[model samples]
Structures are given as structure tokens and as C-alpha cells.
Target: MPFIDLKTQYKALQPKIQRRINQVLEHGQYIMGPEVKELEEKLAAYTGAKYCITVASGTEALLISLMALGIKTGDEIITTPFTFVATAEVIVLLGAIPVFVDVEPDTGNIDAKLIEAAITPRTKAIMPVSLYGQPADMDEINAIAARHGNIPVIEDAAQSFGAEYKGKKSCNLSTIGCTSFFPSKPLGCYGDGGAIFTNDDAIALACKEIRVHGQSQRYVHTRIGVGGRMDTLQCAIVLAKLDRFDHEVEQRLLIGQRYNKILGEAGVTTIVQRSDRTSIFGQYTVRVQDRTNLQKYLNECGVPTAVHYPVPLDEQPAYRDLCKAGHTPASKKIAGEVMSLPMSPDLTIDDQDKICAALLAGIKQ
Candidate 1:
């Protein structure tokens, strides 16, 4: 089975997508066109955020948010090490230090309890990644940030655009929320795109300026910035995809539940979602013993599987010195054990059954 069934999704939305693309082509305002603003408005309304600024990519969203928050060189940003490199890469790109924190073994998200201890006088922000389409504990993380001089909290929600935590959406839960529109993400565009959401007016204005080479107006360079505008074509594509986003979210939830049920019957450990949270099932991963052997057996049985991450960021050569010795043991352990199965809104139950059967047989062997 295809890992992410974008082909099926496209077929279902082909008419709408084609219509939107035709409109964009007729308008011919490729950069920051009408569709760009249309998408921002729709996303802001969907997430209940006061503002949404579309950008070039998820990486740019994080960088722009940090710049808006005034995260400077030598600033310390507390974050977990159990995520994709982009999580830490953005911080380092700004010459800021990423204070490595361990994650909970069950959820594979940053442990909120350890956040306060990592805070120093130089700590400017707390960035928590919503890994595998499940949001981190924003309530607890926000509380910690509030106690410590109201440090800004940025939720790296690249994997969790449609996820919910308590009564709030993932991208509306923190001071700044950033999400990716990589083609494989839960809510994705045709190509590279991302957005930053915020309720604070000042920060929102700052992000708008930062996205366009620090220009408050045309030829009025207000501050240093980058050309991080999301293309109109991508915005049109996302708008087309948005037609069935809610339905897609429901399908993802149903598929996730089915995976949990089937995997549970086979005595496999699936990723756990908390009672107050709802995951979008971006990966539908599980922890298995002898993961390499399990993957090999499944592959032989015509079941495809992949790893979300194979090494903790701290263990990566680029950031080895950033992590304290013997830190982030849980992240390292999970890296070796976690395996992702095929997941998508269009994934069929029959395919799921075949995948589960292969997994069970592989384990038995």
C-alpha cells in the first residue's frame, strides 16, 4: 500500500483543484496573490486565531516566529530532542542555543516537568514540537512559560494542524503556532508552504514584516528579514484541499482507532494519545522490539514501514555539544524502537488488515 495516499485524495478533489488552479492562472498574480490572503483568512477562522501569516515553508514559519519574538543570538530556547532536525535547526540558524529536554516515553513529547529546570536568564522562548500529529502539553508548557517571566511559547505544529488539545486547536494553543504544508502533512498543499498563527497584534505585525524582507511598506526596509512568502499556486492548492479537510480529519481519526484496535489485538504497543487530546494520525507509529528485523519481515510480506526518526537530535553530529552528557535517554531509546506504518485518510480497512496480518506474522517469526 502507498504510505500516504495523496493520489486518492487528489482524485477525489480533482474538479475543485482544477478549478482553483484555473482561477490562479487567469489572475496571474503568482506571488502573494488573492489566494494567499484567502487561505490566511480561512486558516485563521478555522483555528480561531486572530492572525495567520503564510510563509515559504514550515522552517521559515519557525524562524519568522522567533524573529517576531526577538529571539537573538546567545538566547536559549528550551525544546525536546526527540523530533525532526528542523525543530532544533531553526534555533541554531538564529545563533540561539537549543536547551535539550527529555520526552515522555509514552507520548514522545517534551516532558513539561523538565522545562522549568532548563530555563536560565538567557531563555527567551520555549518551543515544543507536536510530534506525529499529536500536540504537546501546551497547558502545562504555557503555565511554565507564564511563571518564568511570560516567555513566549512557540508550538512547532508541523505534524498537527488538525489536532486538538482540550478545547483548543493545536495551532491556536500557544503564543506562536507554526505548521507545515509539506505534501505529506495532515493539511498540506501541492508544494512547500507553512503558516504562523498568533493572537497578539504586535507579534502578528512583526511576522508580516519579517516575512517580506523586513519591509513595513514598499521600499521601506524596517528590519532585516527574508523572502518567505508562500506562492499563490500553493495557496490555491491548499484551498482546494480545504474543501474536504474536515472529512479527511474524521477519516484519519477513524483509521487511527482501527489501527489501535488491530495492533492491540496483536499485542503491539502503539503511540498513546492522552484523554484530553486528539491526534491526526500523521504516522500511526508503534514501538516494536527488534525494529530492524520487524521492518524486514513486513517488507518481505509486501507491507511498507518506515522510521519517524532514527537518532535523537542531541546525538546528531551537528549538535553533539549542545546536549549534556547522558541526557535524553528516552529519546534515544524511542529512536531505535519506533516504526511507522502506512497511514492516510484514504487508507482502506482491507489494506490495514493486510498490514496488521503481516506485522503479526513478522513478530511470530
Candidate 2:
């Protein structure tokens, strides 16, 4: 079976996808086309954010948000070490310091309880990732940021586009939120695409300007920026996918819950999603003591498995010197154990059953 069944999803949305692509083709305004603006508007309204700036990719979305906030050399941005490297990469790319905080053992998300201690006079922002489609404690994080002279908080919602924390959407849960459309995300397009959502008008305006080579007007460079606009074709594809995104999110939640129940009864340890938040099950990860052996066993049994992350960023060679010395026991422990099973909206119950059975058999050996 496929790890992420994009084929199945594409088959289902084929007609709408074709129509949208055709519209974009006919218009022939590939860059900054009408579809781009339309997608930005729809996504902003969907997330209840005042603005959504479409960017080239999720990484670009984070970079652009930091640029908008004027992150610079020596600026400290506190974030979790237990996520995709892109989470910390953006911070370091701008000559900023990535203060690696540990994550919660259960959810594998940034530990908001540990953030305040890491904050200093040089700290510019707090960037917490919504790992495995589950949002971290944004309310608590925001409260801490508020206490610290209202520092900006950025939610790296790369794996949590359609997720919810309380009644609010993931991408609108903090000062600024960024999400990806890397063809495997909860609501992805065919190619690289992403958006930054915010209620702050000034930040929103800055992001919009930064997305297009910092052009305040045609050929008018107002600020240093990257070529980070998501093209009209990609936007069109995402707009088509939006037709059934809500229903897809529900399906993903149901599938994730079923996986949790089945795996738990079979004595497997899975990541825990909190009651106040809904995870889109971006990877449907599980924790295992002997991950390497279990992965090999599963492979032998024809069950594909992958690790979300094997090394914490703080331990990475390049980041080690850049980060402050601290004992992040939880991040280190979780990094060695987390493994992801195949997950997609179209993943069948039968396939899941086989996978769980394989996992159980693998664990026994």
C-alpha cells in the first residue's frame, strides 16, 4: 500500500481538479493570477484570519513570516527541537538563534511550560510547531508570550492545516501561523504551496509585500525578500481541494481515532491527542522501544513504516554549537522511539488492520 495515498485522493477529486487546472491554463496568468488571490481569500476566511499570504512552500511561509517580523542576526527564536528541521532551519537562515526547547512526551509538541525560562532580552519570537497535526498549547504559549512584553508567537502548522485547537483553527491560533501543501499534508496541492495566516494587518501587509520580491508596487523593491509566491496553478489546485477539505478532516480524525483504539488494545503506544484539540493525523505516529528492530520486522511483513524524526535538532552537529547547552531528556528520549505508520484520508480499515497485526507480530520478535 502507498504511504500517503495521494493517488486515491486525486482519483476522487479528478474532475474538479481538471476543471480548476483548465481554468488556470485558459487564463494563462501563471504568476500572481486571480486564482492566487481567490485561494488566499478563501483560506483566510476559512481560518478566520484577517489575511492569508500564499507563498512558494511551507518553509518559505515560515521564512517570510520571520522576515515580516524583522528577525535578524543575534535574534533569539525559541522553538521545539523535536520536529522537521525546517522548523529550526528558518530561524538559523536569518542569522537568528534557534533556542531549542524540549517537547511533551505524550504529544511530541513543544513544551509551553518550558518556554519562558528560555526567553531572554534577545528573544524575538516563540515558534511552536503543531506536530503530527496536533497543535501544541498555544493558549498557554500565548499567555507566556504576553507576560514577556507581548512577544510574537508563530505556530508552525506545517502538518496541521485543517486542525483545531479549541474552537479556533490551527493556522489562526497564534500571532502568525504557517501551513504547507507538500502533496502529503492534510490539505495539499499537487506541488509546493503554503500560506501564512494572521489577524494583524501590519504583519499581513508586510508578508504580502515580502512574498513578491518585496515589491510595494510593480518593479518597486521596498525591502529585501525572496522569490516566494505560490503560482496560480498551485493555488487553483488547492482551491479545488478545498471543496471537500472539511469532510476530509473529519475522515482523518475518525481514522486516527480508530488507529488509536486498535493499536492501544493491541498494546501499542501511540501519540496522544488532547481533548481540547483535533489532530489531522498527519503521520499517525507511535512510540516503540526497539524502533529499529520493529521497523525491520514490519518491513519484512510488507508493512511500510517511517520515522517522523530520528534526531533532535539540538543534537544535530550544525545546530549543537548554535544552541544553548541544556538537558532535553524528553526530546532525546522521544527522538529515539517515534515511528510513523502509513496515513492518508483514503487509508482503508483493512489495510490498517493488516498494519496493526504486522506491528504486533513485529513487536513480539
Candidate 3:
């Protein structure tokens, strides 16, 4: 089975997708066209945020957020190590130090208890990645940020577009939230796309300008920025996808809970979900010993699997010298054990059962 059943999703939405594409093609305003603003407005309304700024990709979203906040050389940004490298890459790209904290053993989210101690006078921002489609302890993280001089908290929500935390959407739960449309994500487009969400008008305005080479108006360069505008075509595709996004999110929630219940009953170690929040299951992952052997067995059983992350950022060769790795044992250990199962809104119950059976058999073997 396909790890992410995008083909089936495409089949379901083919007509809408075709119509949207045709509109874009006919308009011929491929760059920053009408579809771009339409998507930004729809996303803003969906997330309950005052503004949504679409960008070329998730990585660009993060970079632009940092730039808007004026995060510069020697400024420290606290984050979790157990995530995609793009989380830390943005920090380092702007010449900032990425101070990593360990993650919770159960949810694989950054440990908020350790975050406060990491903050200091030089701390410019706090970035918490919403791993596996569940939001990090954003309320607690925001609280900590508030206690310590109201540090800007950027939620790296690349995998959590439709997730919710404490009745709030993932992308609207922080100072600035960024999410991706990287084909395999919960809400994806045909190609690269991302957006930033924020209630802060000043930051929102700065991001809007920074997204297109810091131009306040056409040809008026107000500050340093990058050409990070998401193409109108991709926006059109996302708008098409958005037609059924809420329903898809519901499907993903049910499917993820099904995995948790089934795997837990079989005595498998599943990722824990908190009561106050909802996950979109961008990847329905679990922790297991002997992961390499288990992956091999599942592959042989025709079950495709993946690892969300295999190495903590601090332990990586490129970043080892930047931060001490002594205190991030949870991230280190989880890296060796976490393995993702096939997940998507269109994933069938029969396929889920087969995947679980294969996993149980592999674990017992």
C-alpha cells in the first residue's frame, strides 16, 4: 500500500482540482495571482488568525518569521532536537544559536519544563515543533515565554495544519505559526506551499513585506527580505483541497485513534495523545525496540513505514559544536525507536488492520 494514499485523494478531488487549475491557467497570473489572496483569506479564517501569509515552502515560512522578528547573530532560539532539521536550519541560517531541549517521552513533543531554564537574556525566540501532527505544549510554552519577558514563540507547525490545541487551531496558537503543504502533509498541495499565521498585526505586516524582498509597495524596498511568495497555481491546488479539508481532518482523527486503541490493546507502545488537544496524525508513529528489524519485517509484509526522525539535531555533525548534547537523552533515545506507520485521510480501515497485524507480528518476532 502507498505510505500516503495521495492517488486516491486525487481521484476523489479530481474534478475540483481540474477546475481550479483551469481557472489559474486561464487567468495567466501565475505569480501572486488572485488565488494566492483567496487561499490566505481562507486559511486565516480557518485558523482564527488575523492574518495568513502564504510562502513558497515551509522552510521559507520559518525563515520569514525569524526575519520578521529580527532574530540575528548570537541570538539564541530554544527548540527541541527531535524534529526535522528544517526547524534548526532556519535558526542557524540567520546566524542564531539553536538551544535544544529534550522532548516528552510519550508524545515526542518538546519538554516545556526544560524550556524555561534554557531561556536567558540572549534568547530571542522559542520554537516548538508540533511533531506527528499533535501540537506541543503551546499554552505552557507561551506561559513560560510570558514569564520571561514575553519572548516570541514560533510554532513550527509544518505537520500540524489542521490540528487543534485547547480549542484553538495549531497555526494560531503562538506568536507565529508555520505549516507546510509538502504533498504528504495533512493538508497538501501538488507542489511546495506554506503559510504563516498570527494575531499580531505588526509581525503580520512585517512577514507580508519580508515574503517578497521586503517591499512595502511594488518596487519600494523597505527592508532586507527574500522572494518567498507561493505560486498562484499551488495556492489554487490547496484551495481545491480545502473543499473537503474539515472532513479529511475528521477521517484522520478517527484513523489515528483507531491505531492508538488497536496498538495499545496489542501491548504495543503508541504515541500518547493529550485530552485537551487533537492530532491530525500527519504520521501515526509509535515507539518500539529493535526498530530496524521491525521495519525490515514490515517491509517484507508489504507495509511501508518511515521514521519521522532518526537523529536529534544537536547530535548531528553539522550542529554538534553549537549546543551541548548532554541533557537531551529523551530525544536521543526516541530517535532510535520512533517509527511511523502508513497514515492518510483516505487510508482504509482494512489497510489499517493489516498494518497493525503486521506490526504486532513484527514486534513479537
Question: What is the Cα root-mean-square deviation between model 1 and the actual structure?
Answer: 1.0
Task: Quote the positional error of residue 303 for candidate 2 in Å.
Answer: 1.3
TM-score of each: 0.98, 0.99, 0.99
> How good is model 1 by TM-score?
0.98
Per-residue lDDT tens digits of candidate 3, residues 149-208? Answer: 999999999999999999999999999999999999999998899999999999999999
RMSD of each: 1.0, 0.9, 0.8
| Winning candidate number (lDDT) | 3
Flag regions of model 2 displaced more than 4 Å: none
Per-residue error (Å), model 2, residue 194: 0.7
lDDT of 2 at 156: 97
On a 0 to 100 scale, what is the lDDT of residue 166 in model 3? 96
Please report, in order, the local distance difference test score of every candidate based on alpha carbons: 0.93, 0.93, 0.94
The sequence of per-residue lDDT tens digits that candidate 1 reaches over residues 1-365 is 78899999999999999999999999899999999999999999999999999999999999999989888888999998899899889888888988899999998999998888888899999999999999999999999999999999999999999999998898999999999999999999988999999999999999999999999999999988999999999999999999999999999999999999989887898889999999998889999998889998898888889898999998899998864433788998999899999999999989999999999888888
